[model samples]
Target: MVVFNAPFDITLINAELRRHDLGSLEERLGAETAPVIDPLVLDHSLDRYRRGKRTLSAMTSVYGVTLQEDAHTAQVDVSMMLGVLQEMAVRYPRIAGVDDGALHQFQVEEHRKWADNFGSWLASKGRVDDISRAWPQE
Candidate 1:
């Protein structure tokens, strides 16, 4: 499990958008098996500066994460957050990073890992190559 910690609320919003893509465990994993991995808030130290009544600089505070559950414990992985960074880089370059290629690669890797594990699990349960097989291909 990889957890994504953001420096502020805006970043938390960014994280939520990312969750919409990779961690969409609604169908294959089943609602019971999947934890409600949503945007979260927490108390953390922040280094904020005032700029004409607006807060600026390191907005370290609440963050969100996607988690994986085992028989007993849960885990967080930072890799899950790479998608958020990708989305942010489209508009706000500062949210993720300055490098576009790095972000794209991160997203691809994240998707492959997530799909491999989750898809295999779904297939093991005799769900794969079932409903989708009947659909027409273009």
Candidate 2:
């Protein structure tokens, strides 16, 4: 599965599945959620020092992908995300060179690092937000 923010989307899907007494996506797939690609996570991890927002729209701009329709609609967002991911692969050969399973694992660690760092930053500011370190399914 390719998603912009796999954590948010997968979490929401699992919540709905649980609400209806169904298996989570990972369970249904009969394996851990390997091979799922999240462009947002990839971009953040690969381009850690880039300035400005990392929203889908912003990323599309960064990747030179022209969004042909209004943003936020499911179809439009998916199309733009794929476009952005293609551009990412072109610019970041490492992303294309790694296998999907390895990439997924890399993203899991990257998300944990990001959450820990961001949570520490929040704590330093006296805020108590507990950022989740779970990736792709939390």
What is the per-residue lDDT of model 1 for residues 1-138, given as tens digits with 9 covering 90 to 100? 113322233245445645786342233344422111111111111112222321111111112223233211322233334333333335344423434344433433443444466577788888872222110111
TM-score of 2: 0.92
- Candidate with best lDDT: 2
For each candidate, what is the lDDT?
0.30, 0.88
Off by over 4 Å in 2: none
**Deviation (Å) of 84 in candidate 1:** 7.1
In order, how many clashes per candidate?
9, 0
Give one digit per residue, the lDDT tens place, for model 2 in 7-57. Answer: 888899889988898888878888887678999888888899999999999
Q: After superposition, how far is residue 14 of candidate 2 from its true place, in Å?
A: 0.6
Model 1 residue runs over 4 Å out of place are 1-95, 129-138
Model 1 C-alpha lDDT versus the unseen true structure: 0.30
